[model samples]
Each structure stands twice: as C-alpha cells, then as structure tokens.
Target: MLNLLVIDGVLLFLVTITALAVIEMRNLFAVTMLTGVYSLLMAAVWTNMHAVDVAFTEAAVGAGISTILILGTLVHVGVKERRREKSLNLSALLIVTLTGGALIYGTLDMPAFGDPEAPVQTHRFQKLFDQNVGKVPVTDTHHVEAVAHGAEQHGGEQHGAHEDEFHGHVYNTVTSLLADYRSFDTMFETAVILSAGLSMIMLLRRRSDEEIEAATQRTERVDPDTIKTERMDPKTTQTVRVDSPPGSDSSGADKKLAAEIAEAVDSAEQIQHDAPEETDKGDQV
Candidate 1:
C-alpha cells in the first residue's frame, strides 16, 4: 500500500510538472518532445495499473509516431509558438466560471475514484477473465460447439476448408475472437503496424526514379499562356509599325481593306453617272 501510494505520488508529480512545462515552454519542438515523454510516463503508469492495451497505443502512437511527425514539422517550419501569452479579461473569467460549474455538475454524478464496487470493474473486467472462450457472448457458437465444446477450441478443427485447425490460442476469449473468429482483425492489427512502418518510411523516404516519373506523369501539364498572365485583348495586332506615315503599316491586310473601300465607292459613283435623268416630258407630250 505504501509502495502504491509512492508510485501514484511520483506519477502525479511528473504529470503536474510536465503539464506546467508544456504550457510554459515557448519552443514547440521541445513541447512536442515533452508531450511524448509525458505520454510515455502516462503509459508507464497505465502499465503499472495493469491496462496493457492502452499503454501499447500510447507507446506506439503518442510517444513514437506523433512525436516524430510533429518534431519533423517543427524542424521544417519553425520551433516557436505562433501566439504570445493571453491577457485574461472579465469575459475569460466568466467563461472559465461557467465551464467549471458545468464540470462540477457533471462530476456530481460520477462514482468516487477507486470504488471497487463500481459497476464497471466488478462486472465487466472480472467477468471477461472468468468466462470460457467457448461461451463467447452474442456469437454463433455452432462451429465452436460442434468441435471443442468442452475442451479448449484450439488444436482442433480446420477452418475455411484448409488443412489446419484455427490458427489461434484460446487463452483469452477476446484474443480468441481476434485470432480465430475474427482472424481478419488480427491481420488488421498487423496491417496497422505495417501502415505505421510504411508511414515512417514514407515520412523519411526518398522517391525512386520510377516513382518520380510516375508522379510527373500523374501531374497535369500547365500551359504558360493559360496561367495568370496580364489580361490583354487578343484581337488587337501585336506588331507596332516603325513609321506612322501614310501606307507605312506593317500589315498589307490593313492597306488592302482601305483599297477595297475605295474601289466600292468608285463603283457606286460610276453607277450614278450612267443612270439617265428622269423628267415629266412624256406627260407634256
């Protein structure tokens, strides 16, 4: 009991100090690493308290991957926090008060810490370890019952029509579920570990020549003209004449249009000249 208290006190002390450091430290990289150490210490505490799975996740994700990725980002961009310390006003105090009140109201319904008679521990945790793997709750025990109803479900019966018994141990029913009943889940967990490894490799990875080529192929080719150039009227001619003198335009097409207009005017004038003058001479006769 004294040792347990000592352990708890030490953990609490570390947690408090780490929290303060996290809040006070201006260096984001240092804060991230500190957060990882905090998580590692928390995992240690959880393991000491006999919650193994939670500890494992904290070790892998919180301490290892999260820390690495965050620190990597800090290295790339910067190590400084974006904002300075906030000055607390009345609004801040009021909001804090409301939040504290709500938290207190929520806490009123919570069971006291370490109450052994709490429904969670006495029923859920103890029952899981005590129950038989054959008697898995809410499952079709048909196949399991048919083969090894009494004996442990391992070392017997081929699954999926293959020549081997279900590849699993029946020590814990959940493990039995993961390994045998849900072998895909075991594969999924292995896949998660594989993904983490792949992520680590990718985060630190260099692209191969083929990969680079493939990426280049995947990228869309952009037209320089189509990009953000100064918007100008495309119909307007780009070539500026060296001299502004008459008939000195560089484009013969412009001079040609003027000649066409002049020829049309001449044709109209000749048509008017050839027309006979109309008179009332027939009526006089």
Candidate 2:
C-alpha cells in the first residue's frame, strides 16, 4: 500500500508539473507536444488506478488523435503565438481561484483511494461481480500459480481446491466489469470516439481559401490570342509583347514593309511630275 501511494504521488506530481509547463509555454508547437505528454501521463495515472478502459481511451484520443489534430492545425497556422504586453487582470485570477476551490471542495466528498468498503465496490460492483465472476478462465497460468502459492504461504489449506475453483476464470475484474456489466457505457464511449474522429476529419480535411483561389486561377480559361509574352531587360521595367500565331506575319516586320511601300509610291509620283515639267520645257525651247 505504501509503495502504491508513493508511485501514485510521484505520478501525480509529474502530471502537475507537465500541466504547468504546458500552460506557461508560449510556443504553440511545444505546447502541443507537452499536451500529448500530459495525456500520456494521465493515462499512466488511470492505469495505475486500475482504470484500464479509461486509460486506453485517454491514450488513443487525447494523446493520439488530439495531438495529431493540433499538429495539423500548427502546420497550417504556423508555430508562433502572438503576444501582447498587458497588465494582469485580477478578475480572471479571482475566477480561476473560485473554480479551483469548487473542484477541490467537490473532491472532498469522494471516497479515499482504493477504499475497499466504498459504496461503488460494496453496492454497485458486488452484485455485478457475483453475476459474472469465473465465467472465463484466467489466461495467465503464472497468475494462477502465484495465487496458489500465496495461499499456501498464508498456511491456508485446500490450495488445490482454490486453484480448481478459479480455473477457467479471467484474472482481470476490470475487463469483466467493462465487458459484462457496463457494456452499454463502453458502446456509447465507442460511439463518441467515432463521432469525434469524424469531427476531426471534417475539421482537418479542408482546403484553405488560398489553396482554392490558386486552383481556380490555375484552371481558369485564357484566350490563346490574348496571351502576352513578356521579356525583361535589367534596366527596363514591365515590357510586354503579344505572341503571333504560327504562319502569321510579325507585327514589326509588317509595319516596316508598309512604310517602304508608301515611300516608294511617293518617290515615283515626284519623278513623274518632274518628267512632265522637263518635257514641257524642252518643247518650248
């Protein structure tokens, strides 16, 4: 009993320290990891108290699912938390104190740890154990042997009869209680776990606004003729040229040809006018 108490106290102390560290942590990534550690410590505490079902649930959801969800969120939102300088609020402290006091007061009514005569043991479980005990064989032969040995060490007779009596019986009372007596509760817990998993999937399996916009932009239809090809010079800014389709004339070359044709036409007209004047002058002479 002293050893159990000592281990429980040490585990409780570690749990408290981890919780405080999580609270004081400013980096969200560290906080998330610490939260997982806290849940695992809590699961250990529950296992030590013989609440294996609760421990399993805590380890799976709190340490596994919840940690993954938080890490996913961290990947999206980044690891740093924004901090603002401000004076402490007395009201908040007062509220926290009152809540803590209420919780402590509530624990006062609970039975002492491992109290064999607790109401739950004497009233709630006695009948359940009577109904289902010894239905399944204790799987571990070592445990059976140990029990028989302990009985013999205590100078108790009929060790063989005790072994025979407990033959084919499950050694774990918790399993029987959960599987037989509180099956409905376990079933509901499973349902809750499924629901929570679905909720996390819905929350995490999402496309962000930026991602949606980028996809939309990628799939947007652009006219082939409207596409602009751009080239940049180190000294110049934002120069663009239109792309010509295959077999199409280059715009710059086309403009140059037009200018040459107009200039040739104008020069030929000038020569024709000058020739007429020259011919008139020769006839007059």
Candidate 3:
C-alpha cells in the first residue's frame, strides 16, 4: 500500500507539472509535445493502478496517434499562436473555473482505487463468477423462487447459446468482454475512428471556392482576342479614339488603343488592296 501510494504520488506530480507546463507554453508545437508527455504520465499512472487496458488506450490514442495527428494538423495550421491581444478574458476564466469546480465535485462520489468492497467487486464480479461456477446457489433466499423460475424460463438453450458464443474461449476476460459481451460497443468505436479520419481528410483538403477559383485561373490560358485593346462605344462597334493631338496630356492607355486601331485599319486596307504580284510572290514562297 505504501509503495502504491508513493508511485501514485509521483505519477500525479509529474502529470500536474506537465499539464501546468503545457498551459504556460506559448509555442503551440511545444505545447503539443508536452500534452503527449502528460498523457504518457497518465498512462503510467493507470498502469501502476493495474488498469492495463485503460493504460494501453491512453498510450496508443492519447500519446501516440493523437500526437501524430495534431502535428500533421500543425503542418498546415502552423505552430505560431495568433496573439491579437494580451489581456485575459474574465468571462472565459469564470467559465473555466465553474466547469473545473463542477468536475471536481462530481469526482467526490467515486470509489477509492483498488477498494475490494467496491460495488464492482461485490455486485458485478461476484454475480458473474457465481453464475459461472454455480457456487452458493447464487442467492440470499429472498427471491430464490423467482430467480429459479426466471432461470428455468431463460436457461438450458439460452445458456447453451451463450456458451456457444465463446466456443473457442480465450484466457483473457477483457478480450471476451470486448469481443463478445460488448461487441457492438467495439464496432461503434471502430466506426467512430473511421469517421474521424474521413473528417480530417475532408478538412485538410483545400476545397474552398476561392482556392478552387485561383487554381483554375492560374492554369487557364487567356486568348489575345478576348483582351479589350480599344475602348468601344457600347451602342456601336466603332472604336472611340481620343481627338487630342500627339503631345497633350493624353493617357498612355488612350495612345496604345489609338495605335492598335490604326494598325488594325492599315492591316485591313492592305488585305483588301494587295497587288496580285505580291499574292503570287507569297504563293511561290
């Protein structure tokens, strides 16, 4: 008992210190790493308390895959904290304090660790072992007749079916509980993990409208004909040229548009009145 207390005290101290350090950390990446360490410490505490299943879950989920997932998220979201203001929000602090107090109050009713007289050991385990071993007739005689009658109604074939469920029984009771008794819970946990992975995939994909539009525009080829070279009157196809003489305060845009129009007109004239000799020379070339 003394050794157990010492181990628990040390693990609790480590967990508390790691948690406080995580809270005090300004770097998000460092915080993430400290949070994993905190989880590992909690797993150590659970292992010391002989809760190997819970310890395995904490180590694999809380410390292992969860840390990797958070780091992957940080790759895109970045590790820097966006500090908009240094002032602490009183309302947030009040909410956190109230929530923490409520949680602490709730833990008051929990049984002490490894208490042999706990309800689980007395009620659930006793009933399970008694039912399996067929010892002590499994009753205090108050409802013996009722229990016998119920057993008669639900025994034999039902009991045989239950035994058949574990036809190749294993040594591990936890395995049997998870695979046989609470199989649906195990299945649902698997489904939840799959759904979370799908959710992460969906979130990490750059699927926003703006991002899609930018990618499309970046890859699109713009045609020269699609570009507006001259300012045209909406009512007519004629180009609107500036009448100001060469060196007035006319804008470069207006000059470029005028030059474009003049070049277009000259090209059309040349195409319409080109000499047959020039055409034949072109054809020969």
Candidate 4:
C-alpha cells in the first residue's frame, strides 16, 4: 500500500507538471507531445490505483491515438499557436474556480477507498452476486478465512459453510461491472470512440483526384498579361521584347521590335557576303 501510494503520488506530480507545461507551451507540436506525456502519467496513476482497464484505455487512446490525431491536425493548422495578449478573464476564472470547488466538495461526501461497508459493497448487488455469481475458488487460506469471517459477521451460517462456493462472478469487480452489468454502457462508449476515430480520418483525408485536377485547371488559367519582363540595368536603355507568334495579336512596340530584328539580320547577311570578296581581293594583292 505504501509503495502504491508513493507511485501514485509521483505519477500525479508528473501529470500535473506535464499539464502545466502543455498549457504554457506556445508550440502546438510541443503541447501535443506534453499532452501525450500527461495521458501516460495519468495511465500510470490509474494503474497504481489498480484500475487496469481505465489505465489501458487512457494509454492507448489518449497517449497514442489522440497524439497522432493532433499531429495530423497540426499539419493543416501549423505547429505554432498564434500569439494573444495575456490577460486573465475574471469571469472565466471565477467559473473554473467554482466548478473545481464544487467537485472537491462533492468528493468530500464520498466513501473512502476500499471501504467494505461502503454503500456499493453493502448494496442489493451483494444479493445479486450471491444468487447469480458463485464463489470464486480461493487458493489462499487467509483469503478463505477472511471470506468465512465476513459471511459469519453478516449472519449467514449457510454463506460461511459454503463460502468457497459463494464467491464473486469474477475476481475483478471492475471487469464484471464493465463487461457484464453495464455491457450496454461499454458498447456505447466503444461506438463513440469508433465514431471519433472515423471523424478524425475523414477530416484529415487527402484531397481527391477530382479536386486536385480542378486546382490544376485553375492554376493553368492564369492570365498571360500578368507575366512581366525583369527590369534591365540602368546602363542599358534598350528594352528586351518577346517575339510574338505568327498570326497572333501584336502591339505597336512588338511590331517595331520585329522590324528592327529583321533589318539587323539583313545587315549581318550583307557583311557576310562582302567578307569572302574582300578575302579574294587581298589574296590577289
């Protein structure tokens, strides 16, 4: 019991620290990781309290699946949380404080841990257990004696005689309650988890081929008029012009550019033609 208490205390401390770190963190990715750490610590605390089923669910869903989903969301929303002016809202703070106080006050009236005389233990469920669920075979003599002693205290001579035959349906009451007595509750909880996973998958799914094609078409439809030439150096006054395609609409600037290009090409041909004749005349001299 001492070891369990120490473990629970350490786990709780770590959980608190992780929760605070997550809240203070500005990076969404870091917050997501801290939240997973918080869930893992909570799972450890639950396990220390012997709530294995709850611990397993917390570890698998909260730490594992939830972290992955948050990461997927971060891919779209970005990893950095937007900066906001830090100011405590008095109304929100008051509401949270009252809610927390109410919860703590409510727990004050609840029974202590493992109280055998608690309402739940002494309830009509005991009769149901005695009728439907038979005694679990006890290998430990101490446990058997304890069961016999409890039966005698309850004034059940028959229970004491057949204590071994009148044990719980399952050794673990939590398993019995979740899997048997409240099966429908468990089923609905499972359905809710399944629905949440499906929703996350749907939200994070890749764009379809049709959507991608439509985006590509929109991109291709960009106006050619929006295209502009890079600014030339100030030392050069001449502007570079694009050669318009044949039979395409041409501006006055383009037509002048085409004419200048044609004249330059003719002058280059004339120079080439005279070059061979000049070479022949030099050879004769």
Candidate with the greatest TM-score versus the true structure: 3
RMSD of each: 21.9, 25.7, 20.1, 24.2
lDDT of 2 by residue, 208-254 (tens): 46545544554342222222321122111122233344223334443
Clashing pairs in 2: 136-168, 136-169, 136-170, 137-168, 137-169, 138-169
Report the number of backbone clashes for model 2: 6
Ranking by TM-score: 3, 4, 2, 1
TM-scores for candidates 1 onward, in order: 0.50, 0.55, 0.58, 0.56
Tens-place lDDT digits, model 4, residues 20-134? 7988799999999989989988998888887898999999989998999899889979998777856567887899999999999998989987788898988656755544543
In model 1, what lDDT does residue 12 have?
Answer: 73
**What tens digits encode model 3's per-residue C-alpha lDDT throughout 1-285?**
899899999999999999989876778899899989999999999999888998999999899988998898899789988777555778878999999999999878978867888888885574343334232222444553544555557642222223333333566667766775678999998999899889977977645575455445543422222123332333223323234332222344544555665676677568757754445345442
Tens-place lDDT per residue, model 1, 56-144, is 88888889988988887887889987665474367868998999999999988887867778777675454344432233333444555
lDDT of each: 0.62, 0.67, 0.67, 0.67
Off by over 4 Å in 1: 85-97, 133-285
